[model samples]
Target: MQNASHRIRVYQASDCPELTRLDVSKLGRAYHKIPKIISTKFDSIEARLGIFFLKKYRLNALLSNLTFDIDYHCKNAQIFSTPYGSIGFDINRKFLLSILHTYYGLSKEGNTVSLDLTQSVTKTEDRLKIKLGQELLQLTMVKEVLNETLELKNDYTSIIHQWPYSVRFWLEGYDEYCFSILLDAHHVDLLLATSRVDSESDEPKAKNLSSEQIEHMFNNMPLTLTGRLVSINLTVAQLLNIGPGDIIPVSLNEPLPVFIENEQIFSSVVAEERGRLYLSEFNDKTPEMKYE
Candidate 1:
């Protein structure tokens, strides 16, 4: 029997960039390219009538025009175990009604679209999932229409095969809706890893100080001192006669003045312990005598 060879693959977090927070402003700019208004006069008339009805019902005017954008803040966003990335959009109910009225020509005054006047419109998780599915379907339909019209399958299949990685929808002239394209496990892993790398790169690094900088920082630091004091009155003739072996008598009980940079700082008693000189009994008092 022959031994079989096997190959192993390794994955690292550093291989990917940090998952960046979605920029709503940039998404809004991209969404402006989409044609939202087919007929300006029809859209303007419908929008004006909608605005009048909204004010009559005391509804918020979030969407001023037929192609107006909605403001959305993303929260509780997570990459699911499945292929889809789940995100919650914080939006008002008036905004939802506005969308229905503008796009689908749904009446705002009907019992079918009844909304609580006191409570604001909020999308639940289930509702969001449903909305996401609908949006995905719409996107697919749009892509199909584009392909058919442009004859992309036969002519530009090589150039435009892959769906965009992400799509953003404008809400009240702002980027609000972000849809992440379904990705395979391998691609998802790479995206997350890249996000991590990007995040790590944004952090500030600790810089090392140079030798000169270190020296400059420590130059003004105070130093410890161990000092002694002695006084002797001697004539010029006596000082001239003094030799290396000459013994000058001085008081042993007197405290020595300790100095820090030529300034008398404190006084301490000099003592001997086991043939080693030691400073003891330190006090704030300075010596009465002064050096010339």
Candidate 2:
């Protein structure tokens, strides 16, 4: 059942109009590392599996025939239900028998394992199926992604009639084995969103510039410098009574304050040569007072 507000987008080409479904091609374009992720995880699964499997033999699972399908279904599919959703794996009897043969340390040269597809599944095969499914979920970190804390339920019936989307690939090392991972729109959306978030978070953030670097950058900029030779305090009456041809006596013996605009930064002494007054003896070691 769908909500009343839900709308279905229709696709049109030429003169014909068609109903649009899940666009898996868009997903393919968005994420191309799905195959690599599966292959890498599958290849290294044996290492993280267990001491018995590690000390005995490595499965060395290799991925091939990677594909994405919409509206996929499989008969005799073993499903494991989690809190978030359900995942399923489908393997034929022949493939299961091959895996069983490999599990028991049987040599492929001398060992003759029966490959009857019609044979009923045994208890041992069921256990192996559960173990392999659980291992796949763990190695791929699907459980962690879904935040599934409870153990997967096998006996429980899944609400999903047919998987909306599925990832089908072949695991080839010992023998060619077809593997199907059933997923729905929710799972696809979640995984894609998570990937995007991780990629965004992994990007390098802006770093703070050092004091020396900041100072070096600011030093390169052009600034206005003003020189103050002397300061004379005048009364309001003297300023108003000043007339033409009036001379104000001033001294140039002390060091004059140098300014960048109104802000004084250093001091310099007055020097006169050839009837021209100039500033000399720069000193910026100590802070200077503001020129009023």
lDDT of every model, 2 decimals: 0.43, 0.63
Structural similarity to truth (TM-score) of each candidate: 0.22, 0.49
Please write out the lDDT profile of model 1 over residues 29-108, one tens digit for every residue. Answer: 33232223212233443354346435543433333222322233333222222223221222333444444444444554
Write the residue-wise lDDT of candidate 2 on 1-292 in tens digits: 9767978987557658333354433443333444444444443443343333434444445554455666777766778876656777666566667767877867356777667767677898888877776665555447434333446677446555587657665654535566567765556656666666666679875488789978997986646678887788899999998899999987763778889888878888888887777778998837547998
Each model's total of backbone clashes: 17, 0
lDDT of 1 at 239: 89
Off by over 4 Å in 2: 1-60, 106-109, 141-151, 159-161, 173-175, 204-292
Error of 1 at 129 (Å): 82
